[model samples]
Target: MFKKPVNDWKTSSPLRSSDRKKLRLKIASSYSIDTAEADVLVPEGILSVKFKSYLNEPGVAYLAPDGDRDPLWFSLGKGSDAQREDALLIPTIYTLWKMPKLLPSLSTPKAVIPIISGGADLMIPGVIHCPPSLNEGQLVSICKYERVDIDGAPTPMLSVPLAVGRMAVGSDQLQDSSQEKGKAVLVLHTWKDHLWELGSKKDVPPSEPIKTEDGAEENEDNTNSKAEEEVEDKSNSEMPANLEPVLPEVKTPTYTPDEVSQLLHMSLVQAITQSLSSLPASAFPIPATIFYTNHILPNRPHFPELVLHPSSPHEPPTADSPSTDSPSPDPSSITIKTSSHKSLTAFLKHAEKSGLISTKAPQKHSTQTDMLVTAVNAAHRDVETHHSFATIGEIEAKAARKAAREEDEKKQRAAANLEIDVQELWKPHLDSVELFEAMGESISKQYTAQEVRSLLNSYFATHQLVNPHDQAYIALDQALTACVIPKPKSKKKSPAEEAPLDQAKVEFMKRDELLKKVLNSMQNWYQVKNGDMGDEVALKKGKLAPIQVVMKMRQGRKASTLITGFEPFNIVAEDLSEDLRKLCAGATSIAPIPGKPANSGMEVLVQGKQSKSVVNYLVGKGVPEKWIEVQDATKGKKK
Candidate 1:
């Protein structure tokens, strides 16, 4: 809209059927088109037409629709009014005043309708409703209050759109009503403007003149005193002569179809380069919150450059402003500029789309959005591929990623197949029957890992081995003291002589220390292979392993008991998180515990000290008690 030169789209390359299809896709993406109207967009009757650009200069525009309905402008390219070839250029006043269906419309209040029609840029406070997706730099059509006939039937002809313009600030900026600040839309064109006159060449029926406009209206019976009074009252209330409306501050879209990716990537490059160049050398692997707070907020450049528009285009010459007496501004439309936070967010979305960065929560099972959206070399490596929207580089990159993933999977499978050495534990009941006293019936059998852990917990709870003041600390009884404290240095050394004579320490073990004591009590057994049953022949030693339940403390000091060995039991994480969120009053993380070996399977992390609660929860959900091991995460040593 300024003094900058432009190229006419009419003079650019001619479009074919395929170009039309691409245009349709861009339209759907740009405007939030619904299913019904999507069917009307096609290429058969498509044609090129000329419309006045935002600067009152002539430029070619595309109309995509069948001959049956009004042909709406779908796309524009190479406009002499803009810097780029693929600009989403529609002035705040021009395109909308002629046909509103060309883009998504936001309705203005009845009182402000005619005023904006006369060409004032919209203020944020005036708008009653705006879609969340509409942000700064987005072009929107302005719709006036609907008109109704005597029978209360909606008047379609009068329902024509009032103006078109770009959003100045996003919806968030308009949250406060008292401020009465910030431009919402920049009107590019309006009804009766030069651009509207040029495009009125089509065979459109004119709106019937209302009887109030010219009294009597060439109809005798319709004329009445009541009608005249109603018209007079309406005119006085709605149309104030001195209250002339002017074009408010607004900018038009410079984004063309092909330029979306290019421009988006350009902004990202600018932001990334700016962000990284100024970053401290030691600030790599930075948390996104800190990165955004420290660098992105203050250093990142203001993106999506703005344009200006005069506040009162229709007003006569004044001391503070110039005259707009002509049909079109001779010099150009008035444009204003401002910085934006919304544009930065848009750039982030673009970066996400191009795989320039990735999001990962900072801590496991954490609700906070302290994510890490770190940039990588792959971003710069793939810039060449973004030139074409549907490029082979993208497809090849996807294929390569898939292949690499398959290679990892193959390696994992090979590793899983290879035999491994393991140690087995068999804690007999006779020697540690005091600890196994809680086992009651099952105390006769050799204890597997789960059984051993369960029996030790039972003994600790039954014998009150834990400090009454603090459950996290255990007061080791004689049964546990022998296992937790080291054995005598020599076989001849008595246990009493070697042990610290000071019972003054109260002989305590922390929760983790008690777990180690329990593990020490179990005896390691051999699962040999390829040998005779007797001692006559040598046997090959094999792996010793059993199902285990483990617990770990996450952020917030919340201890989550993890139930592993669910794979052989066919339990899934999703099914667990789904049902447990209700019972726990919080959403539980049911994804596979990260940083584990491949195919380690998933684990459910219920919130709180949930070892017993989870066991009960699983039992209630019909899980067998034998397969479940409630890893006392509260008692485990730090990993």
Candidate 2:
């Protein structure tokens, strides 16, 4: 279910001792493992996290006993309900690697492993071997047969499980192998899926070598031979034509230093002629780092053998191939250092001599020392005649992938910028309490203007207060009059100057004007709501506080920007701090705002004077400009 990266992930408090114990029992019972094993799998001090799959259905609760980074088990339910026995606890790939025998395994052909990893259900015909006692609906591990050398003899051994799923049908149904045609196992988690990406991302552990007595190896070899014979006999009749054993990977080609230099020169020519030729005149004088990374690197030719199979032998000193004894050098790492030239400066000097490019030295005041690529000599002999080793389709595909990645990143940033809408509302004062009560609402509760008008209309209908002479007016009663009229300010006066008290005025008011006066007489409040699911509308007394961004001078010339008021907007302090660190390229910290309640909110402190940057960032994140107040103490005081 976790095919794509999870977006709505939330970490909850560590599980209680009682809850942890209950979860342990549930896992043991559900997986039919020993209580002791379950204890190790899920120990005390376990933290729980909730995350939704790409489908954004009901979220799954992940238990991370080891730490937040290594979530071992996931249960399909709310975080609080994880302790239940029916939580459907599923072990992650990391957990499966630790305890390979945690579940019964079904052996499939080596060719089928990739298909299964791609999220396809294992067909009955693909199963090379199955445990006789396997039952339907039981969780199982899928494994592939690997040819491991044992005592100088090649023996097909079962590799570590690469996937986990439940059996679609029991072994009894598969007795007539030819008759079994449907899916064998319903795959759940796979090796390189999103769930696996959540962990340490370590490679699958190698299968342990079988150790035996002096003559045991021979007997074991014989048993493997007989098993292979049986598999061959069955495959001959039922196996699909396309299903074949995985072949050994071909070795990558190596090159001498001179050859490497030539390749680098050709790549540079291709980069200049094809990649940089289209740059406009305004884009001249690009930084060497950007030119190399964005243009030169992508235009370089890729070794198909090395790209397709990373584990291929890097040895065997063929005249053209790479040495097998050493690992292949990373294509991206093929810089001037690896070429005949000692450095980028020398490489660029040689290119300048060849009349293929122009370069400029760094300015004296610039922070960086790298030279700039001033212009490309597109009409030079080398640039005009260079033939690109990388195909047109490959270049186009790479460009497409880069564009897609950039678009996805933009989408992610937009998603992270949570926009909260805090609406202003009003609560009735004691003088207007009777009116709200008559309309069936608590006097202390807040209401929007529309809601207040609705309530007033209901009250007017019940009281039959609509003016008969003019439909636009409303006849005011004692309760309505008290709520819709402001009390005149009492002025201190001398005895002789005091005037006779005036009787209560206006018995009627325009409906709109009466509503306006009622709202004015009530206390001000605010209601906040965001886009996140299951969040309650937050109501508070007084006006909604704006996010405060203040730049304060610290320890002489150094300055720090402190921001507060994120709680109401549902922004996490730690997340914002991390984003600021990346955006501003400076250190950031989060601390509880001083003088405020522990739960009020957190303050994000970023190094240096970043008040303006912080304000712009919040505005980009959908916070209204008026909702952010920036104060700069570093600025000089007015004369």
Candidate 2 clash pair list? 253-321, 253-322, 254-321, 254-322, 314-323, 314-324, 315-323, 315-324, 315-325, 316-324
Q: Evaluated with lDDT, which candidate comes out highest?
A: 2
Task: Please give, for residues 209-323, the per-residue lDDT of candidate 2 as tens digits.
Answer: 3333245445545534544444455523233422322222222234545555666677777887776888898998987766765666556566522322333333233336644
> TM-score for all predictions?
0.26, 0.37
Tens-place lDDT digits, model 1, residues 323-433: 323222211011111122234344455566667665555577766555566553334655434222222223445766985797678756654443222324465433454
Misplaced by over 4 Å in model 1 are: 1-14, 32-39, 49-58, 64-71, 74-86, 89-104, 131-133, 146-160, 200-639
Model 2 has how many clashing residue pairs?
Answer: 10
Query: By summed lDDT, which 10 consecutive residues of candidate 2 come out lowest?
Result: 241-250
Each candidate's number of clashing pairs is 32, 10
The whole-model C-alpha lDDT of candidate 2 against the native structure comes to: 0.70
Candidate of highest TM-score: 2
